[model samples]
Target chain A: DVKVTQSSRYLVKRTGEKVFLECVQDMDHENMFWYRQDPGLGLRLIYFSYDVKMKEKGDIPEGYSVSREKKERFSLILESASTNQTSMYLCASSLRQGNQPQHFGDGTRLSIL
Target chain B: SQQGEEDPQALSIQEGENATMNCSYKTSINNLQWYRQNSGRGLVHLILIRSNEREKHSGRLRVTLDTSKKSSSLLITASRAADTASYFCAPYALYNFNKFYFGSGTKLNVKP
Candidate 1:
């Protein structure tokens, strides 16, 4: 079975602080994604990496960035955390094949105060 | 607004009954996928139906796709209380890889 591991389950940060969320997949997938889910908004993509050092912005990429320095790890960075950034962050990885299903980590609920 | 929109924002049913949820997308798609998420948990892939495939089944779950109408439906037969979760559909667009648009989801409550 594919396993996607997120570094945290619950996180609390202060305003204007820098925050990092880490994700690692064991299946050697080539695609990784970061999304923030909110009530009534569904899952909006923040950023995605197709390959190492390759990144693409999704619909809501503002106030956030991503890093894919290695194949198994993808990190999401918040330049300056704000209360509006508080949401359940999800990390997912999938094979390079378009037809393959994505494996997701349990998610990290970030709280900004 | 490329996301798939699920109909009937919420649903409630008893155990041993069948539940159906529908999803509609705005544009052409290469495939449509369904996912289930327990409260506070990430989504679990339920089923995937390609544009060319009309129907597919996995265990107690059945999915159908209609390209002409740009819609799809998921049916859970003989649902149990454990089937309670938020069901979402991702309509993977043609030529768009790695980017998935998901709906707000249908909250299913199967009371035992």
Candidate 2:
């Protein structure tokens, strides 16, 4: 079975703080993604990495960035956390392309005050 | 913006009844996938149907896709209380590798 693990299950941060969410996958998948899920808004992609050092912006990448220094780890960084950034963050990994099903890690529920 | 939109934001059904959800997308897709997420948990992949395929089944779950209309339907037979969750449909475009646009999801509640 494939396992995707997130660094934190819940986090609370003050406004204007820097936040980092880490994700690691044991399957060595080539694609990693970061998304923020909100009620009525759905899961909007923030950023994605296809390979080490290669990153692509999704529909909603503002105020957020991603790092993929290694194949197994992907990190999401918030430049300046704001109250609006609070939501359920999810990390997912897939074998190669979109055709394959993505395995997700337990989401990190971030609350910004 | 959400690429896929599911019909019926919420649904309630008896335990032994079957539940069906529909999803519609705006663009052409390489494949359509269904996912289930329990309250406060990560999503679990339920099934995947490619554009060329019309219908697929796994266990008691059935998925049907219509690329011509850019829509798909998922049916859960004999739903139990445990089947209650939010179901999302994700459409993957051909040009975007590993980038999927997800629906808002349909929250289903199976009554015991």
Candidate 3:
């Protein structure tokens, strides 16, 4: 079975503070993604990395960035956390091939006060 | 822009009954996938149906796809308490399979 682990399950930060959410996947998948889920809006993609050091912006990439320094780890960075950024953040990983199902970690619920 | 949209935003059914959810997409797709998310948890991939295929099943879950209408339906037979969760559908575009677009899922509650 594939396992994806997020560093934190619940997080709280003050406004303007920088926040970091870490994710690690044991399966060494080539594709990693970061998304923020809000009520009634479903999951909104923030950023995704197809390979180490390569990142692409998704639909809702503003106010957020990502880092993929290694194949097994992907990081989501909130440059300047605002109240609007408070939401459940999910990390997922999948193989590079098409039609592959993504494995997800138990999301990090972020609270920006 | 969102590609898939699920209808009947919420559903409530008694245990042992069947629950059905529908998803509609805007463009042609290579394949469509379904996922379920328990409260406060990340989504768990349920099933995937390709465009060429009309129907697929896994355990008690049955998924049917209609390419002409760009719609799909998921039927859960003999619903259990554990089956209560928010269900989402992701439609992968024909040319962009890597970029996934998910809609506001259908929330199903099963009464014991």
Candidate 4:
């Protein structure tokens, strides 16, 4: 079975603080993604990495960025956390090619106050 | 800006009943996938149907896709209380290699 592990399950941060969320996959997948889920908005892609040191912006990538220094690890960074940035963040990974199914981590619920 | 949308945002049914959820996408897709999320946790991939395949089944779940209409439907037979969750449809486009458009999801409640 594929395992995707997130570093934080629940996180609380203050406004204007820098936050980092980490994810690691054991499947040796080449694709990694970050998404923020909100009610009525579903899951919106924030950023994705196709390979080590390669990143791409999704539909809503203005407030967030990503890092993929290694194949097994992916990180999401918030430049300066805001109250509006509070959301449930999810990390996913899949094979490099084809329309493969993505495996997801448990998710981290971030609260900004 | 989601590419797919689910119909009947919420549904309620009794145990042993059959539940169906429909999803519609805006553009052409390489494949359509269904996912299940319990409460507010991460999503679990339930099924995946390519554009060329019309229908597929696994266990008690059945999925049907219609490329001409750009729609798909998921049916769970003999639903159990444990089947209660939010179902989302994601249409993977050919243009993007590592991205998918996920639907808002359909929340289902099963009463014993």
Candidate 5:
């Protein structure tokens, strides 16, 4: 079985604070992704990394960035947390191609006040 | 932009009934996958169907894809209360490496 783990399950931050969400996968998958889930918007991709030090912006990358210093770990960073940034953040990992199913970690529910 | 859209945003059914959900994609895809998420939890992969394949099944779940129509359907037979969750369909385009666009998802509520 594949295991994807997130650093935090729930977090609360004040406005203008910096937030970091960490994710790790045991499967050594080559691709990792970060997404934010909203009520009507579904899962909108924030950022994705295909390999170490390689990152790409997804549809809604604004106010968010990602890091992939190693194959097993991916981190999402919020430059300045805002109330609008509060959301359920999910991390996923897949093989080289998108055709393969992605394994997800238990999401982190972030609340900004 | 969202590449996939699921029909009937919400569904309510009783236990032992069969539930069906539909998904349509805007562009050509390498594959389509179904995932389920309980409230406030992470998503769990349910099934995957390639563009060339038409039908696939796992347990009581059946999935069918029609490339020409750019549509797919998922049927869950004898649904139980445990099947209550939000179901999403994601389509992967060949041009994007390891990136999948997800649908709004169908909320399934099964009553015992």
Candidate 6:
């Protein structure tokens, strides 16, 4: 079966600390994305990578960055954790084109204190 | 920026009843997709309708897209308690299919 794996199901970090969220997909998809889901705002894009080492800014890329060192793996980095950044982070993978469906990992619920 | 906006932010219905959700977008799109997410879980893709396609169906889920109106709707027939989840509409712009925007979503509550 196809699967997208997130390294952590839950994470906690202190303010001003750096945090890393990891995601991997075994489906060999070309497009990977990072999004944060909040209570009223829904899911807001942070960043996405189409190919290894190629990344693009999403709608809300202010407090986040991503790295794609391998096709199967994508990493989201939080330079400095803040309380407002606490939310559920979702990672997804899809075919090279958007016409195809995207596969998602369970998600990493990060809490910044 | 989010392009799609789902109407009836929340809906409540009894089991075996049909549920319909609407979505409106502000720009041209290459395709529109629907997704469902249970509480505390990742989103699951429900359906996708290309710009050229008007309607598509899968199982009990039906999706309709109207490019002229920049909107779409998802219909769930005989909804079960399991169908109670948040539904989101995503609209992809132009050639970048992966760059779609998602709305806040419509939370459906199917009471048994």
Best by DockQ: 2
DockQ of each: 0.79, 0.85, 0.71, 0.76, 0.84, 0.72
Report the lDDT tens digits of candidate 2 across residue range A10-55. Answer: 9999999999999999998999999999999889899999999999
In Å, residue B1's CA in model 4 sits off its true spot by: 6.6
Give one digit per residue, the lDDT tens place, for model 4 in A10-113: 99999999999999999999999998999999999999999999999998998788889999999999999999999999999999875999999999999999
Error of 4 at A11 (Å): 0.4
Worst 10 residues of 1 chain B by lDDT: B93-102
For candidate 4 chain B, the 10 contiguous residues with the lowest summed lDDT are B94-103
- Candidate 5, clashing residue pairs? none
Who is ahead in lDDT, 1 or 3?
Answer: 1
| Local accuracy by lDDT, each model | 0.94, 0.93, 0.92, 0.93, 0.93, 0.91
Residue-level lDDT tens digits of model 2 in B4-104: 89988999999999999999988788888999999999899999898899999999999999988989999999999999999999888877767888878
Q: What are the models' TM-scores?
A: 0.98, 0.97, 0.98, 0.98, 0.97, 0.96
- Report the TM-score of chain B alone for all candidates: 0.97, 0.96, 0.96, 0.96, 0.96, 0.94
CA RMSD (A), model 3: 0.9
Clashes of each: 0, 0, 0, 0, 0, 1
Q: Please report the TM-score between candidate 5 and the true structure.
A: 0.97
> Model 5's DockQ?
0.84
Q: Output the number of the lDDT-best candidate.
A: 1
Clashing pairs in model 1, backbone N/Cα/C closer than 3 A: none
Better of 2 and 3 by DockQ: 2
Per-residue lDDT of candidate 3, residues B27-102 (tens digit): 8888999999998898999999999999999999999999999999999999999999999999886466477877
Which pairs clash inside model 2? none
Clashes of 6: 1
Kindly report which residue stretches of model 6 are placed more than 4 angstroms away from their true locations once superposed.
Answer: B95-97
Model 6, residue A92: what's the lDDT?
93
